[model samples]
Target: MMTNLQKASLFFLSFLMISIMACSRELSHDDNEEEIIFKEESSTGEPEHYQAVPNDLVLIYDGGAHRRIQWGKEHFAPYVSAEVNGEEKWLFDGFLFLEIHDGRGRGFASGYQAMAARKTEWENLLENYFAKGNGIHALNEQIEEMRKTGRVTGEFEKRKVVLCIPEPIPNQTDWGQLDGRSLQFFRKEDRIDACKWYIDFAEQLFQDANFEHVELVGFYWLAEEATNSRNLAKDVADYVYGKKYDFYWIPYFNSDGYSEWRNLGFNVPYYQPNYFFSESIPYSRLQEACDRARKFQMNMEIEFDDRALKNNGWGYRLTDYLDVYEKNGVFDSLKVAYYQGGDAFYKLSQSEEEADRALYRRIIHLITQRAEEGVD
Candidate 1:
């Protein structure tokens, strides 16, 4: 029964089969992982300096400007981040900065109030609405009610507005004329306390931003002609963020302090060279503006109105602005942003049916052609 040759043959066959099975298992595992490994090697797993893309080239259509257009759609998504009803809009690696409005720069005013020793009251006030949705406006309303009840009071209504158009509003000041004038009931010596308090309050907002759907890139600041708000922005940058964020502002080209804005740590300033107003000036002295921005390492923003492009009765067609940038060779040389929507494509297309779909295609073609040309 114990044949040595037969026993040896059986042992060899068993070993051979085991080896084949093991080899098959290893090959199958390798087949499953090849694509994943290749993708990982291509997309990530290496240290690299981040390069800003056309994504940085955003189209900012605010409530004051593009009131009608909803930007949370595919057609516009390629151009810029949309302001939607819910903050569910998805743009990979997107960012939003609410500035002093939602960020609560006013609550810090209590730090300079006569009851400087009382911290719990103001702390409780901000803690209630510090991180919630539309909390800043809610905070403002609550503060207003508190003022009515005679429990608290602070800055005048005019200073409460963190951001505004460059034009002065009537009835803002004791004298209707607005300039580098602020009426603080407090003595000048207490102002330092207010600034420090404001900076500390803003830091909390930045911390809370980590929990938001759109991460806060930087704290936006208003450079109103009256207050040197730019300096305030710098103080925040120097103190809280340590110049680690992309500081953004839209400066009127004709305004002073263009170069100084860069020095003040405004790394990402957007320029609206053309306006929707009567002038809507075409690019005549554009090189000077481009040079000014380039000197400080910045770029210009291009406007794309969804309003009736039929004749641009207000002035030149918005498309003309893009064309001008492309012709002048700054389309790619400078970081370009596509500012979209003062109106909807449907209204502007004036088509009987399928206006939106048609308008979308037209825009895509224009932008695609421009990109294909490789404006470098």
Candidate 2:
């Protein structure tokens, strides 16, 4: 009995209602199951989707020891992303250095004595820093919270944290000279005992439950005088093997006898030159060491002094070393070392506020660059 136009309109309305219902059903079905979000295909012209990934590498700087959390937030977190050929690629795998010094106020002469006296204070400091809801602990909690809220843009589920601890050099005479005669009076056994005490203390502090998610990386400073290659190597191996520690780094300045350390079985996974412009062990020598360590399947890390590249001597420039290393294919998975301390030349004369900004900018740049490039 309906007119032809009314019949046509009714039919169209029915079809549209059915289509909407079907679409709603499909969407409900999808919502019930686990969603697989894939990165947008390049051809799709959609924005690439980022997911939480585990952090595999941690690059700790020296700031954490002073109870400063601003560094991680303002400098480290924002710029760390991987890239390929100038395009954004992936996020960083691990954590960075957090400089903790045992012999903070102690002069060389009474270094051991001072550490002994300050042992209780050191433990207290560590407890507060790693305490729940504080310091690195708080930073980590915030990140985890972000993940839970689905706000984290990169892979956070698989990230692991690493703690970088720069060990004190026994003979940092430049700060305050240690008395040789006093040191000589102690027997070798006594000296070893003192060293062991400090190492044990450090290990205890690092292994505490408060540092639950952190892995330790020991940075052994090569002293030109007191710490010979053999001793350093032996100490490092003794300290790290079978411990909760993750890796070892041998900074290359004053490493005149590092070959001895290598020969003695101190297989360091990462090596950075302590100072720019210092002569590195020859390429052949380094290759030999790397090859030898390969029996144990060790990874080597090289760090370029970016500050040196900007200012220092021409020979210390990154361009010079990069060309050589790249030509030799030695930099396949290397990392560049950029310091953000007051030591950098540009920050030397700047006001405290300006210097701090410059320092952080340099750090952020280095971290972001490494993240983009997957630099080791």
Candidate 3:
């Protein structure tokens, strides 16, 4: 019974919640705001629902280096649907994007068939990462499911998919923060030609009915780069724009290059704030970096991986991260990117996982409530 208007407010993405009732559902944490409940009992002897969806644009990386997000999605998707303002609603619906393929070891690898002979041209790419398969059919199955059900709307609305095209230009050595060894394999001089080849391939792959919901959203530039990396693909901006794609790259904030990706016309630069532990939570510096992104018209990509990534030192707690920003009231001011939603919780222990879930669910509900309330 989720209304289209409430659903409209819900930015459709891959990770969906099953049950999100502020008042009824038990949350791991309580909100600072008073009386932040889901369904309110009306004087007329009926329950009036209140929580609206929060995400404006949520992206979920269902495809991992060596995994699928089936378990994660199972834990999250159903909780999003609930009664709102006396009507049943789904809080997670619009603008939700799924990572179908990165041409890596997983996800829609068969889509590489679109490249035709072009795939043969770059055969030196990583074996495990690029070995061909029928994974695109898996993507096709996802599409058929969505199309058959009209995604969350049942109106035959299309869904968006983030196709990962991770290729660096030629054998340039140095693999920076990205998995470039598999993605960056290209012959010298044939780089521009390779760009054109993939653009056509992407256009065709997305043009199919499975991707009808897609609009201005663009591809994930798998080539993660550093500011001073000698092998940076500077010319990619031109190629990406010429083909009219929103180049989404998650660059390290510590790099001098983080400031320049937007200027190069990649358009979607999701800056990662890695300086969290460099000192004792330098809020001012983080704000400075976020402010620079604002000036550049780019977004800050906050991967929860930033907090719980064991490889990244099991990072800071979510509340600690949000407290600094909430105090500064920076959520609305900055065009922040959540990157992939809900996957980081999978890395936590059972108790830790529950805590993380309650925290994020409440946070998203609060953001949605704030946006609905215009609480500035």
Candidate 4:
């Protein structure tokens, strides 16, 4: 008995109800108090459509870190060098010098000692990177030596340095403020304050050291995972940006907040496959990591240890990283971070074994090729 218009309206209303129900799916968050609502297409619950907010939340001198960030494809460009008169530029490639935490547990035992230890460590690293007769300098020489014999042609610059920010352990009491009040890292604000102090202190060291062969382009977050310190990460990032320097992070695979690195305010986040150190992890993880990095618009990290320096059974692991990354086109397409376990690369460069030397040269070749590509 209904008219045609009424019938059409009823059908449209039914379809609208079904569509609204379809879009009502919710995403789970670790913090139960807040939730992110977005439209997703698949069962995997990845965002199909969402809003991205530009990171305009500036840190005031009064002090602060995380705010909303908009994700975009443009954020994932190859590492851009900050060049000035052919010297002192940014990083596309970097060597992670892990002097902040000496594995022997003999140094960096406390925030106060860390401060003193890092001063000496910076001197050694600068010397290694620039001073003649060091391993990194020798590697640079080899890069040029190979370049002269190859078809690849381009200019090379000093290696850009990224230093680590020591974590403010909660019990450390020596970290005092401008007001002479000692900071207790038990509170989040105190930890952030300590980080800001470290940045300021490191900047002073860099200015004083005045190394000409390399650039102090940025600082790295020492924590491998973000964990519950999202605000801490963001505040440090904002503070670093305020200083006009880049903030870098290399989150282990599937670590918390790794996918939302941009949102959390890290300028350059690299995905660590974590495959090199563990024998249980398969090579497939390297490709999987590449896929995840591409998905999240992040860079990649190449990990190797002392095992690669000799006839150790684990030497093949380094080769696996090289092969997988090469197959995935990571060398040509993305910025890379080198994680040579505590002086391993330097040892390799100084090795008397031909096999070890060959491995070192191969790495240099790939690095030169990357520089030639003008990956910006």
Candidate 5:
């Protein structure tokens, strides 16, 4: 009852529809596999996509002078990889080394110690940070492990490192004592000079250390807020930029100068949520924090510590952060900084308790997820 021509036309139409459907499926898969790019704040304070942005910036603090906090191979082991689906996958890709208080009298801020970091103190800090004479340069060891295990290749093989600049706490006696220049912090010029000295000193140390695996990408401002030191901040930033290095800041939630980070001359400014430590601040704080990060076109800091292992409400706080961040798409959309309180993540990784281990796995999964999603 059917004509031969009509039957042939129907067959061709069906074949065409099937081909289109198959091509659509392939396109959808490709979209999912595309690299995750990030938006950076341009000179005009607008969001612009930058392909070279660092994906995850991890803070490695509490390892400076006079402290026994040796970040040796064991401490860095868990940070690099974990057995996921029977394969070792790499974790965070960046490290920011800093300290608030050296066992001696120097501190990064005025509240921590009366004395600012002197030349000798900074020398010790650099030695410890680079693991100079400690028989194990942490960064180098990490690279070796990755290479031996065949985990990192191509550009991902090299890690990024950011060093901290101790705040030039005003009125410190050492300012006048450093390098016999008789610098006085009371004068605006003296404060800027001290910061320049620190930057130059750090550069010298980095060169002397001859670290092969890590790239010195930028420098961080130790002060959480810059209300009183606007002139000092801008001047220090300009000096760092002149030396072909980027300047960074991470102001506390709603702290002074948070909104004016770009004007203050910071290349990267991450907004601190400050949610993990405090018990009073409700979980709702994370929503606001995520909103602020997106609204200001800023990166974010993830805060946690050893207390995450405790069997109390504190543990839940970390879970809250993961949930809130995922819901707000921070895990995928924004660059991140992890502020684990002095090796807490390492403790979690080595924890004997199953709950703690589970928590550690969750955090690693999120971190590795970001890395796999194409972090630069």
Candidate 6:
């Protein structure tokens, strides 16, 4: 016969086992709830991947001339909330001029003073216009806002912002043609003076409260009638770099064009080689330019004219362009500027015809392949 104490001990052990099992079941239930909650929140809330770096192909459309605040509102603000290829992309404004353009009424002195006085107002206007409802300050702030809002949804992966400032209005004007020798003598003083003024103005703006977020400033050195594009590039380079400015853009073309600019001791960070047709310039020349730019720690950017593309009747295809770049092996880091505008490429939900689709696919494939190569 078993003792009562033994019976009582067996009952207690069984009860303890039951309690342990119950606790284990509750823990498993809690884990499942946590997973479900995480998934639901991710799916229902805003996207979290909009802040990624953009692809090599940055499409900058011409925004023309307008005040900084007005230009941002009319051009950049709309694109900030747009999604391209399933990801948010940044739109750069090409040919953005924020100058004080006043006629004889105000004169240069008064105009300069007025711009200086209203500088803070202009900055605030641009900030509010670009980053409203999102706690951001400059262009970078607008990008962060896009990321937080998840305004982009599609197949694209990164975002990058670019701002291009062409050469400011030249200071010299002869109003008529002069002999080559005479022209050189007549323009020398004015050219020097113009360079000084531009440098001083840029430096002043840098010190002022207006141009705080300007990452890259482009000084377009037009090689039209100038004795040497290279000389001009060198002079400008000395001025800009003297001010500790790093980023630069140079137009590259045939041997003459490239050599002239090269002679000026200016290194092209972004190469704008203009090649319309396949045979206009040998592929090797383009590659050489890219290699030279790379040696100087600068990336190559190829510019294609929209008019030429259409005139050539190549169906305005982007593949032809990509193929050339890919063949050169520099496609991985090459920056392509699409001249036609934003409609050249289509985003998700927008269907293009079969031909256009093929063109876009080629571009997308090349961009993806290059991006995967991990070249910044």
Model 2: how far is 326 from its true place, Å?
3.6
Name the candidate, 2 or 4, with the larger lDDT value: 4
Candidate 2 lDDT over residue span 297-324, tens digit each: 2333333332432243322333333333
Q: After superposition, how far is residue 343 of candidate 4 from its true place, in Å?
A: 2.4
Worst 10-residue lDDT window, candidate 5: 22-31
lDDT tens digits, residue span 1-376, model 6: 3332343355445544433433221121222221111111222322122122233534433222232223233233433444345654434322222222222111111112212112223233223323433211244445545556766443333333332222222321321122232222135454444444545544444345342333333333333212233345566666655654432344433323443443454433345544433332433344445445444433455444333233344443244446545654555544444433333342311334465445545555555555445443
Model 4 per-residue lDDT tens digits across residues 8-53 = 3654465445344432113211233321111121225222211111
Off by over 4 Å in 2: 1-59, 63-72, 79-91, 96-135, 138-185, 190-214, 217-229, 232-236, 244-247, 273-316, 319-324, 331-376
Q: Which pairs of residues clash in candidate 6, taking residues 3 or more apart in a chain or in different chains?
A: 53-159, 54-159, 85-154, 85-155, 85-156, 86-153, 86-154, 86-155, 230-264
1 against 4, candidate with superior lDDT: 4
The numbered model that scores best in TM-score is: 5
Per-residue CA lDDT of model 1 for 1-376, tens digit only, reads 4232343355446544533433221121222331211111222222121222332333332222113333233233332211123321212122221211112222121111111212332334334334343333333333334335552222222101111111111111221111344523233322323334544565565465443222334433344222334334454445424524444555545444655665565555656553332232323434344545555554576555544344443223454454445544555444455444433443433434443434444454444444434433
Q: Lowest-scoring 10 consecutive residues by lDDT in candidate 1?
A: 158-167
**CA lDDT scores, all candidates in order:** 0.37, 0.37, 0.41, 0.54, 0.70, 0.37
Clashes of 6: 9
lDDT of 6 at 159: 39
Sorted on TM-score, best first, the list reads 5, 4, 3, 6, 2, 1
Off by over 4 Å in 1: 1-54, 57-213, 224-227, 280-288, 304-316, 338-376
**Which numbered prediction scores highest in lDDT against the true structure?**
5
Candidate 1 displacement at residue 302 in angstroms? 1.8
- Local accuracy of candidate 3 as per-residue lDDT tens digits, 167-277: 533432222222233223334434444545555555565454343323334555554454222343546555655665555566655444666664544555666654333
User: 316, model 1: CA deviation in Å?
Assistant: 4.6
Q: Ten consecutive residues with minimal summed lDDT in candidate 4?
A: 56-65
Encode model 5's per-residue lDDT on 1-376: one tens digit a residue: 3332343355446544533433221121122332322343233544332224567777888544565556777678777667665667777777888888787766666556645666567666666776643322675676676768776433455577788887777665564455667777668888887778778878887788777776777889988777446778989888877777778789887667788888887878899887776565556566667767776777888899878886643677888788777766677767788888887888888888888888888888787778777633
Candidate 2 overall lDDT versus native: 0.37
Q: Each prediction's TM-score against the native?
A: 0.46, 0.48, 0.54, 0.62, 0.82, 0.49
